[model samples]
Target: MSKHTILGETAIQQLLLDLPDWKVIENKITAEFVFRTFADAIKFINNVATVAEEMNHHPEFCSSYNKVRFSYCTHDVGDKITDSDLKIAKQISELARNLNGKSGY
Candidate 1:
């Protein structure tokens, strides 16, 4: 399937099985990562930025203190989940794990 193709419910659910921290909400795959320190959270965000840039797939995110919530969707495909979104979610999850960012608020 094309990377930009919108994923169906079953496909999304199956993909998410490997991404335990991520959940499909309102058509987007989202996860909140909490770090021990605000600086750590910022570091994770910076790493995410670099990866997102390299992949040319940006995520919608918000950070507060030591927590960062990321939401991923393919806007070009009408804000629906796609392969690109799942790929980035995986990358982000890996980045968080490497940086000691705990999943969830």
Candidate 2:
């Protein structure tokens, strides 16, 4: 397993081009998704968990009813957004797209 490191400003900018929905906080990348219901939110979390497991990179998350807040930061680098965070952010966006028409209720 490779440890995650913070990306340079230029690299971060390029990555953010693909993830305009995500916000950068103190160099950490974050995004919050809202669903139609609690069950839907849970399902979304499950999907994220699967992706995280497959990539061996997890996120800090909070959930309540229809909202799921996901914050991705490489703790190995003192909670800074790294290439890993950008990669996962893109993956999460893909997951949302895949579930576009099949949103849980």
Candidate 3:
């Protein structure tokens, strides 16, 4: 399938199996990462930015004190989930794991 093609429910479910911390919510695959401190959270976000820039696939995120929630979807494809989104989500999850970011707030 094309990278930008919208994923169906079955495909999305299969993809999410490897991403235990992520879930489908309102058409987006999302996860929340909690860091020990606000600075750490910011650091994770910055790292994510670099990776996203390299991939040219940015995620929607919100950071609070020590928690950051990241959501991924292909807005150009009707805000639907796609392979590109899953790829970025995997990278983001790996980054969070490397930075000691806990999977939920």
Candidate with top TM-score is 1
C-alpha TM-scores of all predictions? 0.94, 0.82, 0.93
Count the clashes in each prediction.
0, 0, 0
| Candidate with best lDDT | 1
Give one digit per residue, the lDDT tens place, for model 2 in 11-102: 88888887876777656677777666677778788999999999988988888777777788888777777888999988886776565512
List CA RMSD, all candidates.
1.6, 3.8, 1.7
Candidate 2: segments with Cα more than 4 A from true spot: 1-5, 101-105
**By TM-score, is 1 or 2 better?**
1
**Global lDDT of model 1:** 0.91
Quote the RMSD, in angstroms, for model 3: 1.7
Query: What is candidate 1's lDDT per residue for 1-105, written digit by digit as tens?
Result: 455878899999999999999998888899999999999999999999999999989989999999999999898778889999988899899999998888893
| lDDT of every predicted structure (CA atoms) | 0.91, 0.76, 0.91
